[model samples]
Target: MNTFKDDTLGSIFFQVMRLHHIRSHTLMGMQKIHRGQPPILGLLWDKDGRTQKEISEELHLQPATVTVMLQRMEKSGLIERRSDSEDLRISRVYLTDKGKQIKDNVEEAIKRLEDECFDGFTIEEKLLLRRFFIHMRDNLLKVSEYKEI
Candidate 1:
């Protein structure tokens, strides 16, 4: 196995993040879901009917990107879009039976991934690590001068 020549924190952290992303991508692929679709699905699961604009804003995704994702999801029979009863201009997205049924499988896959990521870590250690991550995130946000993203 190859090892990093530069042992800096940033380099190590980048490698960890890359590997985590790759693992997550593969895990999601196994569930027949795309990389960015889980969160959208989760949102819809939480509230079955939401407008496209709501989803886009809530997820902080570009409207065009959300449109494309919704298009693909609609084509795949995972979600259906319908005109709002009160407003014809607005479209609401609702999960199909397939989409609703996949919730359990998607959740299970994520849980497995999380378990793997925290393998061999005690409960206390996990809690501490979570705190450290939150601190790191706050530090970055402060330096970037973005109070909210």
Candidate 2:
């Protein structure tokens, strides 16, 4: 029998499984938010009022994709877009009353999903894991920026 310590393939498979498990739970939690609402809610959670372009940049999504999502969200009464006071050419997105009402529910769902993800971790372990992930993200960002230059 192959020992785990000697199985690089098993380690890689375990990492993939962990990633997929987190992603699946996250998607399921997002699905609970009213249809056509996740991205708008996520943006609003970060900043209640922002331009569509700003949202796209913050979320690392394309402006065109954000526009289409916003249009759908607006049609569904989850968001409203108004001309920017300082820039008439720019449209700022804001959550509607209905959208605000669902914010708590969405937040709760996310919290639950996180709890599920970190079910067995100690508080210190969780903090350490978060630090490691953040460091990895920063390292990758540096690599990407270097490649762009």
Candidate 3:
């Protein structure tokens, strides 16, 4: 079996997550969607007409980061931002028809990637892995404030 150069748990975890991120980016790229845009799109999917601030808070992203993503998405015709009628200063984001249409494609791409990732894992193993991940997240949460990517 091939061994990693650094066999420490932290190193191995980083390597695994890095590889996973690359694969996910590739899959999302195939759909012409950047990896960062999916989370925002997901929020808009669940509930349309959300403000930039709402998206930023919900996704744990900085306001500037969300703004950049929204700008790109608007240019791609995936979403549109309009001034809220009641509050002209607030801009509410809404998914365009193209954005609504790409939901299936995005989901399928994610499903395919997940299927490949868990190819050899059994149901019990998958459940155990999920629990481990949750525990790891909890551990991090107990420490200083952690920002998710």
Candidate 4:
């Protein structure tokens, strides 16, 4: 029984918080798109008319992953891909009427999730928390850059 208190407590707390945050947000988004909606709606919520490559970059996912998701979404009739008028090589993604119709529902779900996450915080406290997370993200980006070097 190696009961390392400090390290074990911090590690477990961080992992649990991360898992809960991801699970809550994912569930909220999925529920909003319930009843046969596309899986890509989660990504589309950020930028509706982005190309698959753009979506992949923004979401920090591989282009191939985005391509597969888009294909499935297209088959489900939740989105359509149109050839760029100026560049045939580029394809623009647009939400179908069905997709557009669910935007409000998705937005509401996100709001509800956010509210739940910040349930007891004041508005200023919530803003500060947001800033703290942004700083943490920036620090991670810096660490990644250092790794690349």
Off by over 4 Å in 2: 1-39, 146-149
TM-score of each: 0.91, 0.69, 0.93, 0.68
Q: Pick the candidate with the highest lDDT.
A: 3
TM-score between candidate 4 and the true structure = 0.68
Off by over 4 Å in 3: 1-3, 146-149
State the local distance difference test value for candidate 4: 0.69
Ranking by TM-score: 3, 1, 2, 4
* Candidate 3, position 104, lDDT: 96
List all candidate RMSDs to the true structure.
2.1, 5.1, 2.6, 5.0
Give me the runs in candidate 4 sitting further than 4 Å from their true place. 1-26, 29-49, 145-149
lDDT tens readout by residue for model 1, 30-51: 9888878998999999998899
Per-prediction tally of clashes: 0, 0, 0, 0
Residue 10, candidate 4: alpha-carbon lDDT: 55
- Model 2, 1-149: lDDT tens digits are 43435558658657756675667566644654433356568778678879887887766777888888888788878889899898899888888888887777766666776776789999999999899878866878787843221
Candidate number that wins on TM-score, 1 or 2: 1
Give the better candidate number (3 or 4) by TM-score. 3
Sequence-dependent TM-score of model 2? 0.69
Each model's lDDT comes to: 0.91, 0.73, 0.92, 0.69
Worst 10 residues of 4 by lDDT: 31-40
> Considering TM-score, which of the candidate structures 1 and 4 is the better prediction for this target?
1
